[model samples]
Target chain A: MNLAQPIYARVKDHILAQIRSGALVAGSRVPSENELVSQFSISRMTANRALRELTADGFLSRVPGVGTFVREATPRTSLIELRNIADEIASRGHHYSSRIEDLREMMATPNLIDDFELRATTPLYHIAIVHEENGMPVQFEDRYVNPFCAPNFLKQDFSHQTPTAYLLSLLPAEELEHNVEAILPDANQQRRLKISSSEPCLSLHRRTWSGGHVVTSATLIYPASRYALYSRTSLGKQTS
Target chain B: MNLAQPIYARVKDHILAQIRSGALVAGSRVPSENELVSQFSISRMTANRALRELTADGFLSRVPGVGTFVREATPRTSLIELRNIADEIASRGHHYSSRIEDLREMMATPNLIDDFELRATTPLYHIAIVHEENGMPVQFEDRYVNPFCAPNFLKQDFSHQTPTAYLLSLLPAEELEHNVEAILPDANQQRRLKISSSEPCLSLHRRTWSGGHVVTSATLIYPASRYALYSRTSLGKQTS
Candidate 1:
C-alpha cells in the first residue's frame, strides 16, 4: 500500500485489488465498514467513504437494508463488435471453460439453405456449447456452420479453442450481421443456462460471411441477471 | 421503379420504398401476396417471392394465419458507436416526436452528488421524456445533467432538439461509458412505454464526459417486443 494516498483511498484500492484478483466475485458480500475499520485501525468515517466511493464507481452495489456486494463485471454489450467469450473472460484474468452439449452433422433446413445459399438438405455442422467464466455458465452458444465454408469444422478441439477463434483462424470474416433481442428463454435454454423461468435473456442472433459465402450462424444467449451487453461509440452511430 | 430488373425484384423494391418513405411502419401489416398480385397484375409466385425474400432479408416479419408486417427497424447495435434515436428515426423517414414528462431543476441526492461529483444539494437538470417513432412510443429517456457543465441546459427546447442533440451541440463528448441490460420494467416504466408486464426492456445506462467534466448520465429504456438493438463491426473488437 502507498503511504502517499489518503487512508480512504488506500482502503478503496485494497478492496478493488481483491475484486480484481477474484477473491471477491459478483453477488458475494463485501466486508462491512466496521470490519474494515477494525482491520485497518481506521476511523469509521474513512471506512464508510471507501465503501461509498466503490459503490459509486460501480465496483460494488449496495442494497439499502442489505450489505454491499461485489458487482458483476457486466459483459460488454455484444451488439457493436463480435467478441469471443473465452477471450473476454481471459482478459479479466478469470478461468474460462466450455461444455459441449452437441456437435454433429445435420441436414440444412430450407431456411438454413436459404441463409447459406446452398441447395436443400445439404449437410451442415451443428454445435451447441455452454461457455463458463470461473466455472459459472455465462453464455449458451448454438451455432450452425456451412460445410462448404469449412469442411473440417467438426474435427476441431473446441475445449481449448473457442468456435469463434477457430472459425476466425480459418478465415477472417469480411462481413457480419447481428440482431439483438431480449427474450423469454425456452425451457431447454433455461436449463442449459441454469436460469429460472422469470429471468429473461439477451439473445444475439449473428451470422458471419467470408469470401462471399455465409460461414456460420449462431444464437448466443446470456442470462439477464448474469450479463449485460455493453458498447461505446461516437454519438449517431446506432448501438443498442 | 427500374424496368430492367425482374418483375419480382421490382415488387420487392416497391415494398422497400414504402418502408423507406415511412408509408409502412413497424407492426403495420404489409400488403399480402394476394393484394400484391392484384395490384401488380403479376402471378402469385412473383408476389410470394417478393414477400419471402423481404422476410429473409429482415425488412419484414411473417406470422402464420395472420400476415406479414413491417419489421421494426432494429437499432444498429452501436457496439462500436453510440447512436442517436432521433437521427435513426429521421434516417428511416419516420415522423419523430418526444413527450417531455418532466424537465426541471432538482437538488442532487447523495447518490446523484457522487455520480456528478458535486456537493450535496447542488441544482441539476432532470428530464423525463418518451420518444415516439411514427406516433408509437419507442424510448423513454430519463436523464440528469450536471448544471456545472451546461448552465443553460433547461433553457433548450427539447422538442425541436433532443437532449442528446442539445448536449452534443454544446460540446463534442470526449468519452462515453455505457451499460446495457435486459430488465423487467417497473409499473411506471411499463405504463409510460405502453407495454405489458411480461415484456422485457433493453435498458441502457450511459454517461458522457467532455473537457474532463462529467456532462450527463442517462437511462434509456426500449420495449423488447418493439425494438431490437443491433450492431455490425469487425470481428474481435468487443461491443455490447
Candidate 2:
C-alpha cells in the first residue's frame, strides 16, 4: 500500500485487489466496517468511506439489512434499454409469437453461479425461447433466473408472457447492465434462427437488478441480417 | 390506397410507397400540404395529419420554416448510450491518445449522400482517427460530417481534442441513432486496429441529429479482444 495515497483509497484498492484476484467472488460478503478498520488499522470513517465509494462505483452492493457483497463484475449498470422482442415486432404491425424451447429448473453450473452471483448447486430457472415476427424467427433468447429473485419463476407459464415481463412484475428493475458482441451462433441457434453459419449474429448479454439483488442474466441472439441493437447519446457531460 | 383505410392513412401510404420505390430519396422534399391535397384529392387536415405522423415516426424531418423531407431510413433512435472512448480509458487510469490518419473535404459518395441525407456531390468533411490507450490502438473511428452542421469542421486540429468533443461544442445533439454489428474488418480497418482477419471487430454505426438535421455519421470499429461496448439501462418505460 502506498503511504502517500489517502487511507480510504488504499482501503478501497485492497478490496478491489481481492476482487481482481478472485479471492472474493460475487455474492460473497466483504469485510465489514469494523473488520476493515481493525485489519487496516484505519479509522472507522476511513473504512466506511471506502465501502461507500466501492458501492457507488458498482464494485460492491450493500443490502440495507444484509451485508455488503461483491457484485458480478460483468453485470454493471446498463446503457441499453432491455426492450421486449414482442413489443418491437408489434410496433411494426407484424404478428409476434414465441415458442418455448426449454424451461426447467437446474443446478447452477460454475458459469451460472458466476453470472447470477449465487452459490454452486443453487437451483436456477433456465429458459430458452425463440421469438418470431410474422412467423419468422428473429431472436433466440436464453436466460437464467436467480431463484431468490423470483421464487416462482419455474412455475410460470412463459408462453402467455415473456420471462422479462414476468420478472418485472415480481420486482420492478432498478438497474440493468449490458454487453454487445458479434459472433457465429452454434448449430442449435443457427437452426432455430434459420440463419447460415456464415451469417454473423448480434449477441446481447443483459443483467437486471432489483432491490439490490440480481434478478436475471440473459443472452439474446439475433440474426444480424434482420435485427440490430440501438442506442443514442443523451445531451450531457461526456463520461463513461 | 385501400378505400377501407382512413384518408390520412391512405395519404401516408402513398408517400411511403414513393419513398420505398426510390422515387423519393433522403433529403428529397415531400409534397407540400397543398400539393398533397390537390394530388391525393384530400382535405388540408388529412394531408397535415399524414405529414405529422410520418415526421413523428422518423420517416420525415420537418424544418421549422422549411418543408418536410425524407429521413435516412437506417438512422432511427438508439438503444445504447454513446460514451466517449477517451473517458472510458481515463476512468481506468490509463493514458488515452488519438492519431489522426486522414482529414479532408470530399464530395459525398452515393452511400455518403444517403447517410447524410444530403444532395449528391455535396461536400462533406471526412475524418479517420485511431484512439489508443497506453499507446495501444483500440478503436478506429471513420466519420463523415455534414458541412451544413459544421461549416468550419476542416479548420480544427483534432490532435489536441476529439472530434466528438468539438462536434458537441458546435451543436448539442438532440437525438442519436446507433447500430451495433460484429464483423470481419476490412484491410484498412485491420491495419489501423492492428488486428488480424481472424479476429472479429465490434462495429458501431452512429448518427446524431440536432435542429432537425443530421450532424454526422460515423462507424467506430474496435477489436473485440481489447474492447466492448457497454451501456446501463435507465429506469423508464421501455420504448425505442
Candidate 3:
C-alpha cells in the first residue's frame, strides 16, 4: 500500500463508524469540505474524495450550495431467489398456513396460451390460495400451471402443503424471472387483508422456466404495512 | 385445442382486456361468481376458475364476505436494466444536464475492500454528480469505481456524459443485481432535489460486476411524486 492509502482509508472508516454508531443520524448534515480538511489534517482534495465516494455509495447525500448529510438506508431485497411464502414465514419463527380459496383443472385461452407458452387450447390447472403468517393474511397467491409440467396437480390437497412446495418438489427449474413493485390496494384487498383503502400493497410477479418449458407463473400481493422483501448481493455481482 | 381450453382462455382474456381497456377501472368491484357464470354461459366451475386465476395474477382482488374487485394496475419495474436518467428526460422532450459537484481519486477502505472484493488498501476513484432535467434537480448520483476496472476514470469529464453511460461503454456485463425501494430523502437531498421535507423519495440501488471483478456500485435517489418504476414478463413456452 502506498503512504496516502492509510490516510484515505482512516478518514473513510471514521465517517462509516459514526454512521453505524448513530453519532450521525439519517438526514443530518456533516462538516463541509474545509472542515473535513482541517479535522483530518488532509488536503482539501482528499477530503472531497471521501465525502464524494460515500455519497455515491448511498451513505451520504450531497446537494449543490448545501452541505452533505447522512442518508437513510433502504433495504436491498433480491428478487431472483425462488423462495416459498410458507417457508419464508416459517423461517421467521411464525406459524404458516394457507387456505385454498379455489382450485380447478381447465383449458387455456389465447392469453394463457401466450403466457404459459402452451399450444392453442391446452389444458392447465389454476389455484387460488391465501397464505397466512401467525393467523394474519399476508399473501394472496394466484397461480397457473401447465398441465404437462404437473399432470396430477389437482389430486394433491393444498391445505397441508402449498402449491409452491409441491411444484418445487415435483419439478425444479434452472432459470427464473421475477418482477416486484407497490401500488394502492383495492376495496377487496383492503377488506380481505383487514386493511383500509388508504394502505398500499407490495406486489410480486414471477415466472419459472425449465428445459424450454414454462413451469408456472404467479402473482402475489401483500399489504405493504405487513410485508417487506429483502436480498443481499456482493459487490460487482450482476443481479438480474 | 380442446373444448375446455377456449372457455378457460376467453374468460381470462375478457377480464384482462376489460381492465386494460379501462372498461373496468381500478378499485371497481368485478362481477361475482354467479354473475360471471351467467354472462360466460360456462359451468360455474369455469367462471370460478377464471376469477380465481386472475386474482392470483394480481389483476383482481377478492374478499371473502365482500366481493372481488379490480386491483390497481401498478406496473412492475425491473431494476436490472440500467436506465439513463438523461435519456429518460430527453424522451419526455425535456432538456437534461448534470453538474459535477465533486470528483476525485482515493484509496479503498476495509468496507470497500470487502464490497469490491479487492485487496486491502487498493486505489479507487469516487465521483458525485447531481443530474437535472429541465432545470429541476431530479437525481443525486453517487458512485465508486475500482481503478483496476477503469484505470482512467478520473480523466473522463462528466459535465457532458454521466458516469453510468461512461461505465456502460467501458464494461458490459451479462449479469446485474438491482434493488429498488421508497425512502425519505435527507436534508441534503431535499435541498439539492428541491423537494420539500414532506415528500418521500424513491431510491434505486444497483451493483454491477463483470467476470468476478467489481466495476461500480451506485444508489440513485428520486423524489417519489415524479417517478415510478415499470416492468413486465411473460411465460413463453410450455415443455413437458
What ranges in model 2 sit over 4 Å off?
Answer: A1-79, A119-121, A232-240, B1-82, B93-97, B110-114, B117-121, B134-136, B234-240
Model 1 is docked with a DockQ of 0.19
Looking at model 1 chain B, report the run of 10 residues with the lowest lDDT sum.
B231-240
Count of backbone clashes, every candidate in sequence: 18, 13, 17
Each candidate's B-chain TM-score, in sequence, is 0.69, 0.64, 0.63
Cα lDDT tens digits for candidate 3, B152-239: 8899988877898888888765334565654556798888888876565556666777544678877777676666554433323222
* Residue-wise C-alpha lDDT for candidate 2, range A122-213, written one tens digit per residue: 88889999999998999999999988879899889887788988887787775677777767778998899998876777788888876456
Q: Per-residue CA lDDT of candidate 2, range B34-114, in tens? A: 899899898887798799778866689776668889986541112354456776566344679999999999998999878
Which number leads on TM-score? Answer: 1
Model 3 bad stretches (over 4 Å):
A1-77, A106-110, A119-121, A234-240, B1-159, B165-178, B182-202, B207-240
Ten-residue stretch with the least lDDT total in model 1 chain A? A231-240
Q: Once model 2 is optimally superposed onto the true structure by TM-score, how far is the C-alpha of residue A181 displaced, in angstroms? A: 1.2
> lDDT by residue for model 1 over A90-180, one digit each (tens)?
9999999999999999999988887676645788999999999898899999999988778999999999999998888887675577777
For every candidate, what is the interface RMSD in angstroms?
A: 10.1, 7.7, 11.9
Model 2 chain B: weakest 10-residue lDDT segment is B73-82
Question: How far in Å is the alpha carbon of A141 misplaced in model 1?
Answer: 0.5
